[model samples]
Structure formats: C-alpha cells, structure tokens
Target chain A: MMSGSGDPAGLDATTLNCHELGLSFGGHKVLNGFSVTFAGAGITAVVGPNGAGKTTLFNVITGFIQPDSGECFLGDKQLTGRRPHSIARLGIGRTFQDVRFIARLSVIDNLLLASNAVSGPTGIGLRAFLSEKRIREEHSDRCAEVLETIGLTQKAGDTASTLSFGQQKLLSIGCCLMNPRKYYLLDEPFAGVHPELVVTITETLKKMSKSSEVIFIEHDFEIIEKIAERVVAIHQGHLIVDGPPDQVFDTDSVLEAFVG
Target chain B: MEYVLHILMLIVIYSVLAYSLDFIVGHGGLVSLAQAGFFGIGAYAAALLSLKFGLSLPTVFLASICLTALMSLFVSVPSFYLQDDYFVVVTFCFQMIVFSIFNNWLEVTRGALGIPGIPLPVLFGWEISSKSEFIVLGLLILAFSALCIWGLTRGAFGRILHGLREDEVYTESLGWNVRAVKIIAFAVSAVLAGLAGSLYGFYVAYIDPTYFTVMESILILSIVIVGGAGSFAGPVIGASVLVLMPEALRFIGFTPSLAGNMRELVYGLLLVLILLFRPQGIAGKYDFTQSKGAR
Candidate 1:
C-alpha cells in the first residue's frame, strides 16, 4: 500500500464544487442553477425535502449524469462530463439511495470486490491462487477489520440478500471501507438501520472524517446533528442555506421550506 | 482413435467459447447471446484467410481475433446502453444477422456448404497431421484461455467487472469508467470466442452456417450456467458435463437419433433443476437472483 505524506494541506483534498449545476429531465429543470462548495474534510450533510434533488447532486458530482451548463471540480481535477467509474477512481466513493448490495454475493465477497480497486485488474484466477497465501491473508484481515467495525463480522459469509435491511445497509458501508478513498458520498446511510446500528454508523463516519471527507444526504436531522460538522440545505434544486448545522437549521427560509 | 481425438479437440475449443461467454453473463451480468456470431466471424475469417489467401496458421488466427473483435464493437455499442433482457435481445439480433450472412452470402461464405478440406496446423517445419497432435494443440489453446480468464478475474479490472455486475450505477460513483470497462470486456470476450471458433473450424476440417446457429449459442450458455458462473472451475465443469452427457445416454439402448434427443433432454432437465434449486450452479458464490432483477 502506498501511503502519502500525513500533512493535511499536502494531502490532495477533494473539493466537490458545483457552479451553476443544472439538470433537466424532459425539458422541466429538476436542478436549476444549484451551486455549493464542499471543502477540505469533515461530514457535510445535505438536508432537504423528499424531492430536493439531493441524490441528483451526488450523481452529477460522480459523473453519472451530465449537467446542462455548469462545472464540478474534485480538488484540482475538473470532473465535468467524465465517466462515473473514472470519477470513482479519482478518489470518490459513493453509496446509493437504495442499498445496492450485490444480493447474490456473500457479504465478505462484496467487500473483497471493493478492495480490488486497491489491487487493480491483474488479480484474477491463477495469479490470485499462486499468490493466494499472502493475498488471501490480507483480504481476510482487511475484511475482518471492516466487518468488525461495521459489527458484521459474524455475517461475513452470509449471502447479502439474506441479511436484515439494517445489516444490509451496514454491509454496503463495509464494502466502501475495503478501498479507502479521499471523498465519500453516502446517500441516506441511516435509512432502514436500527438505532444501535445508527450509532455505529455515526461513530464510523466520525472516525472516517479525520482522514477523509464525507458528504452524505439524510432526512434524519437528529443523526445529521450528531455527526455533521456543517450542513448544506437544498430546496427545489437550489442551495437555500449553507453553514454549521445549528445556524443552518435555525434559518427562517429553511424552516419555511420544510414547513411550507 | 481419430474420432476420439476430434471429439477431444472440439471439447477444448468449446471450453474456450464457454469461458469467454462466462465473463459476460457470469461476471459482467450481461447475458449476451451473441457468442455464436463472434464465433462464426472467427471461423469465417480463418477459413477465408487460409483457404483463399493461403495465409499461415498464426496469421489466420490473429486475423480471426481482430475481425471478431471488430464485429463485437457493434454489439457493444447498443448492449452497453442496455442491461439484462434488453441487452440479450440486441445480441440475439446480431447472432441472427451473422447466421444469415453465412447462409445467404454465397460469394463469401460459400452459401452454407462450408469451406472444406482445411489443412492441419503446421509449425515452422513440422506438420501436425495426426488427430492426437490436433488435440494437443486444442488443449494448449484451452489452457491459455483459462489462464487469461483467471488472471483477469483476480485483478482490479476483474473486480470492477464484478462491481458492475453488482450495481453499475454505484460502480460509476466509485470513479471507475463503467462504459469503457463494459466495451473492453465485451471486445476481449469476443476475441476469445473468435480464437475458439477458428480452432474449431480447423479441427473439424469442415465449416457450415448451421454450426453457428443460435442453438450453438444456447449450448455455450448452458455449459456456463450448469457448471456455475463467476468462478474459475465453472466452465470446466460445464464443458465436461456437456461432453459426457451424450456418452452417458448411449447406455440407454436407443438408436443414435433417439440418443441425441435424450442427451439434449437431459441437458435441458439439468439446467432447469440447477436454476430451480441451485441457481448459482456448483462453484458460484452468488445466486442468479441478483441478476434476475438487476436491470
């Protein structure tokens, strides 16, 4: 594993800055001139109503969809109109609004799949078998570590489809841990999770914040208040407010957007 | 002895085809039904080069791979945008088109008569004229194909392919080039199928449009599904069952025609049972249910 210098400034910080990011579906604009700058590191919660285009923002950042006329930047890398996997390889890892666990695969295998990004494309059959002693040991060790962190060590061998909804959510996060990235884009990580698991997730995010930036979208403001250092509130495809969690929540416009 | 060697050679050739298809359907989650089209292109390329142009074996083989890969690009264009059932339909159309060309294009494909009397592969100065030698050649190709697949699956690229299989949308967010990876995988798989097809054409000493039909594609798919998908041993197991099933049917005291039907029946029965009970097949770690709703 190649370790970079530990200096926070020296480390290439991933900044997802959107300038006039707009997207239209069938002519009606879903996101109209939406813009926000997520800087450095720490958890930045994107809080909004059900249809505020939060997930769509994550999509545009990750290059899943093209913006009509705007730009997205990851650190110094201009990420506009690139492929999603290429964006992911550029140090951005994202979860889904719907937990996208490979339902047929074992939980550990799912994690192993994520870990492949670190190893690259040469690790398949015979070579994997020939180097099995060391590779398997490393994979097992890492998988054990992440699974234990997510409290899913016991369910490592279980098929993903067989797990409870909360466990499945944890496993999805666990998969992301196999390959450590600079930026994490989590879509509703707290959804369907139990209270205890939610605490575990919050702690995991807190730990992750020290080394990497986390931008997560969530409806539960309580959880957001617990983990988020900053919040960006969106309303109908626009950034209505951006600041620390307390101030953003106390704003009259945010209250009106939610209430009215 | 010659007949045995021929059968063995065919097995090795089909094993490569089956392995290539496994990458698309098994790992990439694209149940492509166009292996036969690519296979036909390979056979036609090799046959044309050797029979008409009088090219060497190695040259023919390389040309076959290139031609098949080029044709695969067309399949990839539409299939890349679609997934699962829609992708299958696109590939199926390509298969039909390839077959039609082979059957109707009299000037080039000989109108299904199949260029006959293909000579045995010859090295620099050595002529590999015997059937056993041909079997050895086929086995070597099969070994190479297996190694390639094994290497691919264990690498980062292979994992990305699996991730695409799991959830392509999520995979995109991980900074992986989903479209590029899909196209590369599809093209590589087509090349492998082409190699197998070229080898099969040479070993059989005859070529015909009927051999490259949709049924042939189904047989290759069945081999992958029955053995298992997404595992190294799956294709090997699938190929062995397909090869041996017919031999096993001979003990049932039926005529050759009846035996053929019985063998196919058995194959279908086995596939159905596996899909019903063990949807993941023998060595597969993941079940088919994931692919069921993946679109």
Candidate 2:
C-alpha cells in the first residue's frame, strides 16, 4: 500500500465488505463462509492456489455470481446480486482473469470506449453521438497516458486483435484505468505480461492505489511482496492467512496450501 | 438507360436497408431477422399516411420512422435478455408476427389485395415521378441517413457496440448501461430501415403482404452476408452485388423470361460462393463464422 495508512487525500473510508459469502457449484464449494473487510485505500494482494476461490471471491463481489448466502457492501451501498454494470457504476472497476476487451476495435479505441463520456448519465446514445468530437477530446489525454503507461502508444491505431497476448493483457489493464473507479479488482493483472512492463504496470497500479483501493489476484509472491502492503491468502474456500505480506508468507497454512 | 437507373435505385434502397441492418448485426452483435418487418411497418405507415392523410413526403417519412422505431422496441427489449441463438429466434418470431399482422389485418391493409396508387414523392413542389428524379431523391435520403449513422457510430458509441457484441459482461464492467445502449441501437437501426421502407413505398407506389415476409428478411440478410456487415462500405457493396448482379443477367444474352429464373439461380449460387470464400464478407472486418455463424 504505497498510499500508507494516512487516508491523507481526505477521502471517506469506502470499504468492500463481503460477509459470510458461501457459493457452491454442483457438489463442490467454491467459497465457504468467505468473509473479508477491505477497509482504507491501498493495494491488497489476494493470493491463493488454483480453485482456492480467489477469482470466485472477486466474481461474487462484482455481481457476476450470486453467493448462495452472503451480503457484499461497498461502503453503504449493497453490491450483492446487483447487475455487473450497476456495481461498476458504483465505482468497482475490475479486469477478468482472461482478458476480454474488444478485439475488433483499435487498441486506443478499447480505452476510449471506457472513457467518462462513454459512461456518462446520457450513456452511449444520442447526446454522446452528437458531441463525439468534443467527448473524444475530453479524455484523449488520459487515454494517451494509459496507453503510454502500458507502453502501447505506438500501436494505438492498430486493431486489438493484432497485439500479442502480453500486450493485450496490458491493454486490458489500460482499459480498466481509462475509467476512474474507487476500487479496482484485477485478476492476474500481470499474467502473460513481459517482465519489464510488469514493473511499469505495477508502478501504474501502485500510483492508482494512492487514491483508489487496488486488489489483485496474483500467484507470484515476489511481485506481490514488492507491491502489496496487505496480503490475504485463501485456501480450500477459506481464509488461511491475512496480514502483512511477510507474516502471511510465514504462516504455515499458507505455505502448506501452496506446496500441497 | 432508364432500366439501369431503375436497378441503381433499387440498389440504393437495398443499400440503406443493409446499412441499418449492419448496425444491429455488425456492431450490435445480434443477428436480427426483423429488419424486413420494420421495413414493412415503415412502408405501410408511409402508404397510409400519404394515401389517406395527404401529408407531405417529409412528414410521412417522420411518421414512418416513429412507427417503425416503436415497433422495434418489441424486438429489442426482449433481445436485451436473450443471448446468441435465442436472440435470433426472438427476431425470427418478431418477423413472423409482423408478417401475420400485415396479412391478417384485412380491413386496413386490404389483405392480399395490396395498397395501390401510392403517390409520387413531392418535396418543395418537385414531383419525383421520373426514374431520374426518384434516383436523385433516393440518393439524398441515403446521404442523410448514412451521415446520421456515421455520426452516431464513428467514435465511442460504435466501440461500445463492438464491445457489447464481443462480450456483454466486459462492456458492462466498463460501466455502460449495456441494456439501454442495445435498446437504443435497435431503435436507430429500425428508424433507418423505416426510412428505406418509405422510399421503397413511394418508389413502387404499390406494396403487398408478400413483399414483407420472412423470406424478404432472409434476402436482406443475404445482401449483408454477401456484401459484408461490419464495415461502412460493406453493406453498400453487398447491396450492389445482390441487386445489380442478378439484373445484369437480363442484358447478358438471357431472355426476359429466362433471366427471371436465372436471377434467382445466380442469386443463390452467388451467395453460396461468397459465404464459402469470404465468411467474413467481401470487405468486412468481422468473420461471422468465427464469431456468429459457427454458433
């Protein structure tokens, strides 16, 4: 958490509190009594092995899946069972584990689609259609910055499908950053990313965490240790360890889950 | 010369139809079979408004647009909830329903008797009765409609549609009201189709239930498939091929009676070849088989 514990931006404490979230698919339990309170603004790394419910927790919190029994709150707003778009509008921007931005659009267009003007109250309709030139100018600078941060400035006009897997992964993150949100849930943000650009993405995410709460699901602990202030590790649909990265890594259960 | 102009006029009208259908199919990512239904609604609305009310051409166009757009809501609202094949089914059902209404509503529509004596379009006291004048009027209408469609779909709005087509969840996560955008896309698409229909009614001055069946819907879709769907020029090119190429058979040593049968034969054969070679379309960026057809 590069922002520290100060909350110095004079921001109110908006937390994503998932209480007693239990989800079962068929006879298997994906998240059993998965509850956690993400308070304050900072970067938190959600670490877990495959099928340990890390992504499922994000899916539940983001309204893609309804928990059999649970309630999720983003500050005073209830997020559980709401439409994904409504939750996003409520300021929870997220990236999928497998990137899903529009491949047909130009690389820059993907970010532009997420611009504030595109997300305004009038929506992607007549008003925006009528004032597209002005709307495009309103956020071209920000789109440029995100593209530059993701190191894809030169490839702005190329179709997204032309990009390599890693660049597309970075574009996915770039798309998320284009729209300002209070909370960002990135599932494996650095997956398929080049080593050097991973640092670049980390810096960007770290910078964003200064004002917004950034939670990521990553398996690489070295990168997690570098960026994450708090690490919440889950195993077998339960929270095994949750504390500072050093302590959570030292926990025997966390080690056992990853190793076994 | 006049015959060529006639073919060109038909091409322009079909081009308009393809362009609007492209919005829903190419950008919106929903294959709708209800475009001809909306087209029929516009044609019927225009015929009745002009024949009965004595309204001017512009007013008739406006009324047709409103009526057709309203009718599109019946398809779009449900389409927002349906996915992929189910959505296509809904549009297919909507097409059948529109045809039924046109066929069974005998008193108002005159059943199979058809509406005749649709007046020539008049704008600012210029009667567009000649083939040349009708072609000019069609061009102007096409220009206006294409300009509006271009404006509405050039920037973020178009990208949002592409996003919605690609992945609704990803589009929703970007904070767009996917449902609302999709519904509006349908309205815009139908309005343009309605405009085409109005031009169609005034051009022919005669229309019947048979002209607006599910088969007609399939023809419009074939134009899109042969021409291409996603690109701006794809549908226009598609319309030209599907309209003019078949007609060319009449001039190329084929008797008038033989040309009619040959036209249908060539139309079907041409469509098959185009799809086999170019499933994405002649110039379309989207590969329908990969994204749409295979599903």
Candidate 3:
C-alpha cells in the first residue's frame, strides 16, 4: 500500500483523520484502503493525476458518498455516516469543482444561500419571516465583507451567471467564506483560472488558512507550492507522498508521475 | 359590473394557486404534476366539512390546508429518491390517484353526481354571498397569500430554494437539509393551493372532480410556466392573462362554439410564441432548456 505513516491522532486532536478508507464501483476500486490525516489548519493540497480519486476522496469526506468500509473523523465527531448537511452543520464548508452557485441570483443572494442560521426549520416559519429582512441585511453585510476579501465587492449586485468564469470561481469561494467554519473543502479552485486570478485566489487561500483548514485539490504545481503549506500526493487511490511542499514535490515517483 | 367582479374573483383564486405552484415548480425546480390532487383534496375536504359538519368557512379553510399539507408529503417523499423525470412521474401518478378517489369515492365526494348547494362562506357573522362582497373576501385572501409568498421569496429562505433549483448537491453542501427544505416548500404550496380550492368551493357553491382534474393541474402549471417561475409577478400576470383572455374572446367576432376553441388556440399560440421569443417567460430569468449544467 502506498500510504503515508503520518499519525494525525498523535499530532493534533482537532485534525481530520481517515482510517483505512476503501470504496469501489463494481470491480474497479477508486479508493484502495487509503488513509491520511489532514493538518489541523493551513492550506493542504491534494495533488494527483486525473482519475486518481481526488474527487472521490472529497465526496466521501463531504458525505456525498459513503465509503465501502472505513471511518472518517473530524476531531471527536464521527463524520463517516453523517448526511452532507449534517457534515456542513458541523462546520465543514465545501465548494464544487464546477463553481456551482445559483446563477440567476445576484452575487449577494448566492452568498446568502450559504449564510449561517438558514439551516434547520428555524429559517422556515413565521418568526423567520418577521426577522427575514434583518437577517438578509446581516447576511448581505457579511457577504459584502467576503466579496471584498475575494475582490468581488464591486459586483455585489450583479447576477452570478453574468460574472466571468474567474469571478464565478472567486464567488464560489466567497460563498464558503460566508459563515466562518473550522474546515473548508475547495475542489479544484485553480482549475481553468488565469495566472493573475490564480495569484489572487492563492493569497485568499493563504489568508483563509490562518484560522481554518483549507484543503484544496489542484493540478498546477506552481500554485500548489505557493498556496499549499502541506501537500499530499495521491496516485491510484493511494497516498504516495505526504509532507511539506519542498519534501513532497521532490519525491522521485511523484515528480515523474506529475511533470513527466 | 357583477360579471367583471366575478372574473376578478376568479383571478384572485387562480393567482393564489399559481403562486403556490410557482413556489415548488419555479423556485424549487420540482415539476410536480400532483398540485391538482392537493387542490382537489382541499376542495373535497372543504365541501365535505361544510356539508356534513356544517363548519364555518374559516374552519373548513383551516381543515383543507392541514389535510392538503399532509397529502403533499405523498409527492415530497418521492422527490428525495427520484430525480427529474422520475420525480415528475411520481407526482403524475399521485395526481391520478387523487383524481380517482375524487371520481370514484362516491361515499364522500358524491362522485359524478357532484356536490351542490355549498353555502356562502360566513366570516365573523357576515355572509359573503354577493359578488362584490365575495370579491372583497377574495382580495383579502389574495393579499394575505401574496404577502406570505413575498415574505418567503425575499430572504435567505428564497435564496436557499434558488440554490436547490440551481444545484441540489451544492445547496446540500452548504448545510441545507435539501429534503426538508423541499418538503416544507411543497407543504407551504399545498396549504395555499388548498385554501384557494376551499375558496373556489364556497364561491362556486358547487364542485365536481372535473374541476380538479389532471387538466386543472396542467392549467396551473401553465400559469407558472407562462408567467415566470422565479419572478413574483409571474403567476399573477399569468393568471390574469389566461382567465381574462377567454372572456375577452367573447367580445371578439368569434361565435360561441368557435370562441371556446379559439381561446384554447390562442392560449397555445401564446405559449409557443413565448417559448420562441422569451423562453425564460416575460418576468423570469430561468430558461427551462438551459437548466442543465448551468451551475
């Protein structure tokens, strides 16, 4: 098994840990008993070739898919069998690789969809209706703050579909930033982005990692080195290398599999 | 004057139904064919309560809402396990089942014989029997329903529904209990639809299963589609156009036999034209064909 020996339980109690995770479709195994513990905070990039199960790993972690057999833990909480919304309520924010957002809605409304307290039945009744304006204003204020952080403050009132691809990507990330959480799973934030916007996003991720765990998937090594303090390299559903960017990127097989 | 008031009253009732349908279809993106079933349930429920129990209009209204809300679960539960066409199929089946009950359950609904002499609604000791008086009552109810829908669509809740429509997976990832939100939206829609049906029963002073058939459901769906899905004014505008268009046809040179067919022909033509010219609807932003991969 091409697995790393990093013991997340031994290191930090708040770290996200997965134990012997295995998942398969028919006879094809996508995640072959993969195991790794993410850093408690800071940006960690999961770099691997296409079809290496990076997205599947994200799916399992975010409760979109249940592993065949294994346990996932975030701190003391068991997240393996929880629903996606339950996982989200536990402070795990997620962004899609496609930058999925309500395009017909304005940028502010899109961000407000992920705003806090809109979860559960509390946001559905007469009481919710009474305070809806206040809540909207509050969320809009926070969205404005997030848009400023992501350099989308000028386009707050603009519809999401009208935004450029890079701006949409930034908006997707800004949505995750609406309510501060302990962990953020950003799937391929740098994909199809320009180099300048990539720098902007990298800086945003760096700032985000200051107080929360920002685990991202990226194919670009340069951006990975700049943004990712820790790197976990996966090949064929197994973690081939896991360490600092300097150590992990220097691995012979990882370098060959990626660049070569 | 009386005829115009009657048409305006009908507009109010249909506007309520259109708004309710829009909540589920336009905002939640669930093309439910079961709305007519809930509407039928409300109508039958109100009619029976009014006839058998001799309850007040307000009591019958409450009962209808509660009953139809519970019935909405029949479709909402299927939504969790099904997607797109399958979800619509399930709703279609539920709609048929409800219509069958209304048609075949002669013991309660009176079947083809139909229920007659449903008394005018008495609100706070005032009988709303006259056309003008009923119009006032319908307007009040319309205003209330409009207010509730406005409240729902203007806040974080509305945004979440839009999110569900846009991408259920993404909305789920954002900590929204997608199933619960959709179920609640369906229930709220059913409640309003039920209220409209109850009002229809009291206003018409009679009702038959024919009034709440799958065809009626299609008409309500058309109102949502023709008006606009997400826009607040879409349903009201759609209801006004559809209800008044047929009446306006009477003023035109067409004979009675040709006019009825002409109204339908015009309706179909208008919908086709709207599809060609403005696929998102007059006030809507969502294009039906463009819903896929739009995230």
Candidate 4:
C-alpha cells in the first residue's frame, strides 16, 4: 500500500455542522432546536437516554430523516433536504441503531457492497461485462484493509449469517469502514459487543480519528470518558451538555437527564 | 428434425426471457409480472416495424430495447416507492394494459386478427429461413444475453442489487441510489424480455394478443422458480425443464387437445410441488416464498 499520513481518501479536513434542526414524529418533537458542530480529525461522542433524539440527530445530518426546520452542512456543502445517498456521497458515513446486512452474503461480499470501486446502475447493459475485472482489481486493497481492521480476515469467505451477534455487529460497522467518508455517524457502535472486540473497535476508531472525523452515538460512559475528547449530551430533544468529556460528565444536568 | 429444431429454438428464445426475469426477481429481489408485456411489446415492435416499415433485425432489437426500457420506468419509478406486493400489482396492471393494446388497437396491431408472416431478417449475409438456421440465431442471442446477465450479477452492479434486495435503506446509506438500481434492474430485464419477444415473433412468424397475457408472465416466472433463480445456471435449467416437460405429454397417446389440457394441469402441479418440496428451484439458491432479506 502506498504510505499516507491519514485517510487514504483524504477526508479528514471537513467538519459536520447542523443548525437549529427541528423535527416531530406525530407531535412528539423528536428534535427541537437541536444544533451542534463537529470539526477537526477527532472522535466526538453523542450520548443521550432513549428517545433523546441522539440517533435522530445523526439521521438528520445523514439525510435519512428530514428536520422540520434546520440546515446541515459538510464543510461548505448544504446537506439538509438532500437524499440519503447524496448526503453520504458528500462524505458522511452512517450506521443504523439496529444493524442491517444480508445474512446469506459472504463477509467479503457484504463489505464490497459498500465499496466505492463498484459502479451503480450502469445503463450500458450488455457492455458492463468488459469493466468487471478492472473494478474487482481496484477494490481489492480496501477490502483487505477492512477485513484486517474488523479482525475477520480469516472469516472473509464465511457467510455473515453464521457469525455471532458481536461478529455481526462488527460486520455492520465494517460496512461503513469499507468506504472512505469524512464523518462516520455510528449509532451505538459498542452496544451488545464483546468487551474484547470493543477494545479492538476502539483502537480502530482511534486510528481512524487521526485521518477522518468519528462521530458516534454511544451510551457507555467509561469508553466515552476514555476516548472522546468532546461530548454532546441531548435530553428531551435538547442539548444539555457540550464540552470536554470530563466537564460534560460532571454536569448535574447530564446526571439528571440520565437519572430522571 | 424440423420439429425438434423448432422446439429447441423456442427453448433458447424463452431462456432469454427466463434469464431476464430472474435478474429482477432473484438478483434485485423484485417481483415483476410485466415480462410478458415487454415481451409482447418487443414482438409487436419487430412485427410492425419489419412487416410495415421493413426494418433490419439490429435496428428492431435496438428500438425494442430502448422502447421497453423507457416504458419500464413508468412502472419502476412510481411503484418502487411502494412495498413489494404493491410493486407486483403495478406490474400486473402494466401487463393487462399491454394485453389490452394488443387486443384492441386494431389500427396499429391489427387487434385480434394478429400479425403473421413476421420475417426473420438476414444477419451478416446469412439468410435464416429454416428452423435449424433460426436455432443458430436464437442460440447466439441466448449466449449474449447469458454473458451480459452473468457479468451483471457477478460484478458490483450485481452487488448493489443483492444488497438492496436485502436492505434498501441500508444500501442507500452506503451512498448508492437504491431506487435507481431497482429501476435499472427492471429496465435491463425488460430490455432482454423485449429482445426475446422480437425473436419469438420472428421464429413463429405469427403474433397475437393471446400469446402475451398475465398467464404468460406467470409462466416465465414459473420457469425461474422451477429451474432455480439467482444463479447463472438456474434460468437456463428452468427454461429447459419447464419447456421440455410440457412437450413430453404429446407422446403419451392422448389426442392433441387432451394433451394440451394435460400439459396445463401438469405445469400447475409441478409449480405446487416445487413450492412445497424444493422452493429454490432445481438450480436456484434463493427461495421465492421467503420475504426479501430474510435469508
């Protein structure tokens, strides 16, 4: 592999920003005046109790959910009101709270599904056969790197259905890891994962943070305190805490949001 | 020899149709009942453009492919936003509408009178007049269709179809235009269906509304289900088994009309048995009864 200091795709320079994002699910007010900005090549943890709109914020930023009133941006590009795929193409990588993948697909095939090397909706019909070999070759290096990162190199050929839950979770995360995006929006990346794999995933996120922005919705405070340089806490669809990890943890409102 | 050649040519032609539908159903995890419509459209295009306008085979195929692909967007774009079963209903309607056109558009289609004497054009200086010659042409088209579909399913485009087949939203989050991919799947399948339709008309030297109905679409889908879907060998095997099995009834000493009725009964039973015992078809890796992404 050619040596590089950061993201091979050079996605580290951009920041993710959302302003006054408002949304409601049947007047439930999932997000109300929610706003946040994340810059630089470092990991930021977004923590909240259930229904606090942490995941909803990620969805809005990623364009999976449209906010009632707001705007989002990636560096300089407008993201709000755009399609999920277009927002993703704007350099935002997102994962779901409930992991989704084809159970029958091989681990490698699942990862390759998200690979940038593959062209989509090629209209040339019968002529697409000619470029198949070249596309396969171009995608090989990234696949190897992702397989190694998720520690599934040996199980690359195995069907994902056969994997354990933790392994499956890692496989889902590995989908986002397949392509290079400026910001990775992971929803509960550590939930239900084995401690051992969590440690491995932590190292991977850390390594990734040096080259790309890692913004994840996490619940566990121990890992958050250890790894997150910054933390944003939301409760009842409003931001309650935003600061260094230690400061946010010490805030009484942060405890009130969780305890109440 | 001519009769056997005729049966063999029909298999090759319908194999292209089977492969086309499999690309949408098995690969994209979509259910479309409009293959017969596109097929009929292709046949009509070929019959009308050739007998009326005297177009060449290449031009006829190209025009049919383009026209069918365009018409497919009418169903694909709107129906894809709905659920799977709703999409099927849309295709069913599309099939009905096409059948209606073939039956009632007397000025253009000659309605129920049908179009006959569809000429098989000369290709590369070869005048294809005999059933054996027609088989050669059908095999060439089948081979090309197989290669293109095989390449599509094995490549990244296939990966998109497979992934979206599993999880449309998840696939979208990966930055792929999942809707576009689904539409493309329909268009490409329709393209091949149109090609097969054109060839079928030419080979039979006849066309009518009765030839393309909702039942014909079901038959094509049955072929995919019986032969297996989602595998390169599945549709080809399916087409061979489904086509050849019905003809086997002809030698059972029953009268022609009795044998014809017997063939339909057997086709229905075979599908039921396949669904009950071997849901994946003889060569298919996918179970059609299972909901998308379940496997």
lDDT of each: 0.79, 0.83, 0.83, 0.83
Q: For candidate 4, lDDT tens digit of each residue in B54-145?
A: 88888888999999999889778865577688889988999999999999999999999999888877776687788888888888889988
Residue B209 in candidate 3 has what lDDT?
89
Q: Would you give me the overall lDDT of model 1? A: 0.79
Greater-TM-score candidate between 1 and 4: 4
Instruction: Estimate the TM-score for candidate 3.
Output: 0.93
The digit string of per-residue lDDT tens for model 1 on A1-35 reads 11111222332446556778889888877788887
A1-260: candidate 4 lDDT, tens digit per residue: 01111211332237566778789999899998877777756888999999999988988888888899978777667788888888877678888888787787899888877774234333223332446577658778888998888888998999988988778878887888877778888888899998999987898788778777788889999999889888989998888888888999899999999987
The segments of candidate 4 whose C-alpha lies over 4 angstroms from its true place after superposition are A1-13, A117-132
Say which docking band candidate 1 falls in: acceptable
Residue-by-residue lDDT tens digits, candidate 1, B78-178: 96588778888998999999999999999988886878887766666567777787777778888888988887776556766777887777665554556
Question: In what order do the candidates fall by DockQ, top score first?
Answer: 3, 2, 4, 1
Report model 1's chain A TM-score: 0.89
lDDT of 4 at B274: 97
Q: Residue by residue across B1-295, what tens digits does model 3's lDDT show?
A: 8888889999999999998999888888889888888877888887889888999988898898789889889988989999899999998999999888888999888898889988778998999889888788888878888887888877667777777887888888888788888888999999999988888888898899898888788888888878887788988999998899888899987888999889778878988888888887878766776765374
* Per-model DockQ: 0.30, 0.44, 0.52, 0.42
**Better structure of 1 and 2 per DockQ:** 2
- TM-score of candidate 2 versus the correct structure, residues matched by position: 0.91
RMSD of 1: 5.2
How far residue B108's Cα lies from its native spot in candidate 1, in Å, is 3.0
What does the lDDT read for residue B82 in candidate 2? 88
DockQ-best of 1 and 4: 4
